[model samples]
Target: MGKLREVEILLNQTQKVRFERAMERLQSLSSTTNNSVIVADSIPFNHDEAFLKGHGTSLVDGELLTTVCGVVNHVDKLVYVRTLRARYKPEVGDIVLLRYSFVAQRQSRWRVDLNSTQDGLLKLSSMNMPDAVQKRNTSVDELNMRNILAEDDVVCAQVGESQRDGSLLARSNKYGKLHKGQLLKVDPYLVRRSNLHFHFIESLGIDLILVRNGFIWVGEHTQSNDPMVVDDEIISSKTRQSILRIGNAIRVLSTLGFTLTLAVIMETFDLSNMENVQIHDMLGSEFHVWSQRGKLKEEHVHSKKNVKALI
Candidate 1:
């Protein structure tokens, strides 16, 4: 109550009418809700918190309002607002990778690919750089459209503010770059915009690039102890199926929101499935079928005959 600079009971005609109706209802329910009574004319119609404080009391009008959380003594104090909040609050500000196709020196703006709708723009002047820093980078020749960034090149960036009239902005040269790795894309709808900061991979080689549209990765794969890799690549294909299949399996698990454990399962399944299949039988079948087959197709029979004559 002491927080009030002053108190008033003033009310407009409409509020007076509303107050009357509310008071009538309050007569019966106020005992249970424990709200203070409203004086008809002398007290006026006090809507602000200064005149009313609900320590253990309810308001007659509180029931009538839909959106307001009950009225309080500290209404105007701005207590609930939080500072240092992350920019993208699920509605916006998902970390996005972009490429700058155009940078305008005159307006000091960048034309960036946002992966949806039209491209986004980041203005140099709005980067909030200090004058001293600006002078230091002055030799950089402002910013040419193509010199700083060209088509097809990728950049790691953060989502910035959007205009009410429909424009998007992003920034993040200070954050980090999209280094060498494989690209992984998840369905855009599956990713909560707020979840962008939560992505992490324990492996040194694997990194996730999350965006609203999708994510791209750039990395060499680690070897998995899958027997499928040994049989498919080493014995049959003679390639590093272990690492490649592990990478693919990791990708599928990532799409399903499963973490690294799937990599182990993929390896285990490869070994388990390979034990039952006889590689000798497969090779024998292939040899018999291939050996008995004709060397040439119907169209190639004439060429085969010419070669036979030459031999």
Candidate 2:
């Protein structure tokens, strides 16, 4: 069966009970707009008038409400649904990736960028210390922001209580510290905010970060002289662009059955139309192509002077 057909079958199977309940509820209510599904039997405006915040409006066949100028259209199927609730929650015990941005010794509070618009505070008292270490007596200001969290060193921290306003607070060394990891980001609109945990890249064996801010990142943990080499300089423009185009296209087609695979021609070096192009050349050319397509009128083609080639 087709993918969409399979999806429809799955949706129907999962939502059968809920669908029946919604239809029954709709039949009992008096709605101004027709929100019912259009089945084979009767066309009674059907729709579940309940408005769920992030979730979509529940509608079945045969419900009625408002139609522009009295024209009526039956509900065939629901195209989308909203997440029921959120999965990720900030608490005192949880370890989180943190970025420190400000430090004020006099105030005895430090600021952290916890993937939120406003920075969170970290009180000095939260620092965990052994009794022996505390007795050594070191200078207080010695714990400078730069020393603790140089500009962008990612750290792990724990959530703390706010002083007055509702701004969040956190502390590292209180729980533990984060060293290195990858980050992955997904469109927030495409995911249910409450289901943040589901977006994690655990299956990929990489740390998944769902910053409260929309950005997410995923990085593989590498430790070796020859850790997974990513050639930064040698790729050609045309090849680079082709890779990105193919990647994006593959991503868009993921929900469908489209898959990219190396053909037999690629295994054997039959470099006919496929000239030896560098990664840089492919990337630059692809970028240029996109840039040219974006402009209203044709302009000069982008220069590929510094771009390198990749085998």
lDDT, candidate 1, 1-311, per-residue tens: 01212458797543453344344434434455432233221112344544442232333444311112212223453212111111222224556655556664444666665555556665653332322133333535454434544565455555655643223332223332233343454434333444433233333233344455444433332243221121222222312333334345434333332222322323322432354423233223332232113121111212211111100
lDDT by residue (tens digit), candidate 2, 1-311: 00111233454322443344334334433254443322222223224543221123233343322211111332444232222112234444334455556675445555665554356566545543322133332456445434544555454444545433313333222232333342322222222223232122222223333333333333332222222222244444544444333333222222121111121111111121244433334333343233223331112233222221111
TM-score against truth, every candidate? 0.37, 0.34
TM-score of 1: 0.37
lDDT of 1 at 78: 23
Candidate 1: worst-modelled 10 consecutive residues by lDDT:
302-311
Give the C-alpha miss distance for residue 34 in model 2, angstroms: 13
lDDT, model 2: 0.34
**Winning candidate number (TM-score):** 1
Off by over 4 Å in 1: 1-91, 104-107, 125-140, 143-147, 164-176, 182-186, 196-200, 218-311
